[model samples]
Target: MIGDMHPGDILGEYHEEVIQLYGLGPRKVLVTEREAPYPDGRLIVSRTDTDGIITHVNRSFVEMSGYTEAELVGAPHSILRHPDMPRAAFKDLWETIEAGKIWQGYVKNLRKDGGFYWVKATVIPNVRNGEIVGYTSVRRKPDRRKVEECIPLYASMKAKEEEEVAQ
Candidate 1:
């Protein structure tokens, strides 16, 4: 909720910019340019409903994402999507998981403080009674080489997406 501000607001204007996130309905997020380094030797884990609402998160997820358990539980997993991430990456993830297959990839995630972090994410379908009910994602420190390699590729994909949108 974008709210009215009171006096002595240190973060006043720049932090308020929000966007209706993709595939996450109308939920919005503030974005920033800062990058947060992933902690070494820590793995972040989370689970989400089929519609992508967060169901569970590990302590590392909570600490790294800067979101409390109460704040994260009912939120869309896309709440953590960084704007720098190209939509095509998520599109492929969804396609792979929806087909009941595991998908592993490098990803950039957004934190509640408007900062970003990179991770190597493995998403698995939670299946029961021959049906996939939800997804569980385990994320670890992404290889620096892969993260560096993806930067320009993702930028190109984002640019192509924007070009298509402007058509």
Candidate 2:
């Protein structure tokens, strides 16, 4: 179903609706620079439930993922998942978050066109009154050499995780 989308389709639709609703742009930005730590190169941010269902995404996230707010909301976070990414890596990420900590790593994401890009991602668990509620992620362009080194290791880990899951 995700393959059925084209780049800019989602963004275009959101632009129209937003312009119509607020005359231009959002009524108020949900995630602002004052609230976030990273302010370099348009930080991409997304919020997801514990089940990975996307709840909110910022303008940068929409622009980078090539998906509109309507399409992204309520969708699985994996909508942007790259096939080459290893399951074990995600498992580790989940473990880190579930343990009440943050997970920081590089990620390879697939665009609507099947092209891929790399990001340095920081995923944090959203907690309320000592209980985990959801997750929030901030991503930015990653260093090329770090990505290159990670790819092969991710592939091997993916293979291993798949083998283990299969059994």
What's the TM-score of each model vs. the native? Answer: 0.86, 0.72
Candidate 1 has its poorest 10 consecutive residues by lDDT at: 1-10
Candidate 1 lands at a TM-score of 0.86
Regions more than 4 Å wrong, model 2 = 1-40, 162-167
- Per-residue alpha-carbon lDDT of candidate 2 for residues 66-114, written as tens digits (9 for 90 to 100): 5679988987777776656776677789889989899999997754433
| Candidate 1 C-alpha error for residue 40, in Å | 1.6
lDDT of 1 at 70: 87
- Distance (Å) between predicted and true CA of 33, model 2? 33
> How well does candidate 2 score on lDDT at residue 43?
79
* Candidate 1 residue pairs in clash (backbone atoms < 3 Å): none
Looking at candidate 2, the ten consecutive residues that score lowest on lDDT are 14-23
